[model samples]
Target: MMKTMKILTALAATMATIPAVAHEIWVERDASGPARIYLGEPAEAVPEAGDPEFHHLQKPQAIQSDDKPIAFVRRANHIEATVPGSGDVRVRDDSVFAPWKSGEKMQGAIFYARAGRSETAAKLDLELVPAAANADRFTLLFRGKPVPAAKLTVITPDRWQKAFFTDANGGVEIPKLGAGRYIVGASHTEEGPAKLGGQDVASVVHISTLTFVR
Candidate 1:
């Protein structure tokens, strides 16, 4: 467990830093081919924005499913790799953006992403997972425990978004918006000594997203 947590910064902790960049990282794979990791908003495109952030992905080629390594390559705007199985594919990047000032304190940010939903186990230190198979219910957990009252943003396939807070169980249910890709974005803040781009930070913000087709 200690070894896994070490690699986490090094994916995040508490309220994340997403205001400045407004960019997010996620993975996508249809019946067409390999899973592709992306850095941007779900329903919108930042136009060549992903390539620049691609360099910040320093973690080894990885996917939580099966605990095996996969080779990811930089494409025109995203990272692509062939995953091993149908299980969820998770990705984390700690150095994507430089730490920025958030109010009185300077904060660093870490981003975690999952390509598939419905996988119940918590692969990342923090994540949003389906509470049950064949249901729209979901839960936000940190290290396998509920992250209660956290703010959650749901982005629909049509570039629409709605924001709300989680219930006591760290759970929320979103009515199926449509027949396209959907992304649920949530963040938490952890205070401690951390580094962003090799610089010291007062606290680290973790931004996690769950992407899946409805």
Candidate 2:
């Protein structure tokens, strides 16, 4: 009975350490600091329906792009870019608190093959080079869904870049993309072509749409 009791005690101690490995935001400074929480007050706690202070807090500056869509720039997060045509773009989400961190790099790619090739879907590999460690985060949206298409990897020598159809199989040959069309676009969570609140922020190349065909 003593031996069994000892084993059970050891197991309990090991299980106690699991919570430390999970990082969490807190409101207090104690070891088990106040956990980060979202506002969920009742409607009565909100100010008057049309109060100026309340409205101002919720209003977001709208941006415009002549014929292109605005990429999202996580509000309240900071990022920089050296590309001239790039400006602070719009993130595609409208959540109260966007989860992307500042300096996260963003990119996308599209593969195209001949209309009737035996291997129409090709596999490709690309590297992303960021200016700093943890400097950028990558979010890839393909056909409107987030997939492994990104090949998540450690930051490589060529971070902050993109490539398409890079495999050695005949599937990669340009001929395989028999005269068909494809669309690909990319944007940075931190950078943009226009200054915040500027009239022309939306038209920047922050949201780049590319069309390729054989």
Candidate 3:
């Protein structure tokens, strides 16, 4: 089961903009592949009327810096990113706004993930022992699309109760991604579903660096 605890708003704001300072940034799997360029927000707020990029985004001006990607992926909202220094920033809808409130400075994962090649997907099995009873629902996000539904399973502690998830594609399973390092895990949050903070006891399981192959 997952619990919702409010982190201090002051901290969240600080950790949201760490990716703006980078010399060179690009998401890479190995060598030859397409990596998205993370364009950052301006240092000082550019006038909304004068700024051409402002009106295009849901929340402009507040976008993090173009500093090298604190994390990397081909596209946005396809995978979860882990910010190394302070904390983490979860990407929800390919959004440009930071995941923090005003005045709240935070240090966590402040990177974003996006779909790359077909090789970025993988199969994962998680053993969830929640702090309390939960709805027993979670999502396996790879890049942005769900993994093969047949590959996901939720097993109860009793060893008898088991449930299988279904992909939108009738009986056919979702795509089995190619070979690459993918940040794989489960999330319940709708906005920042893959964004994880604090302890591992929460509803999400950010197990390891997932790599798929031929």
Top model number, TM-score: 1
RMSD (Å) of each candidate, 1 decimal: 10.1, 20.3, 17.0
- Compared with the true structure, what per-residue lDDT tens digits does model 3 show for residues 160-204? 222345455312222323332322222222222344333221122
Tell me the deviation in Å of residue 87 in model 1: 1.4
Candidate No. with top lDDT? 1
Better of 1 and 2 by TM-score: 1
Report the poorest 10 consecutive residues by lDDT, candidate 1.
11-20
Clash count per candidate: 7, 26, 33
Candidate 1 TM-score, C-alpha based:
0.81
Model 1 agreement with the true structure over 1-214: per-residue lDDT tens digits: 9999887855453334434456778777775468888876666764675644555555524545465667777777777887776767788878778787666777888888986776777878789888776368888998788999999888888879999788999999987888988888899999987878888889988989888887
How well is each residue in 66-142 modelled by candidate 2, as lDDT tens digits? 44532322222111111113222221212222122122322221111111111211121111211232222222333
Cα RMSD of predicted structure 3: 17.0
> Model 2 residue 5 lDDT?
100
Q: What TM-score would each prediction reach against the true structure?
A: 0.81, 0.18, 0.20
lDDT of 3 at 120: 20
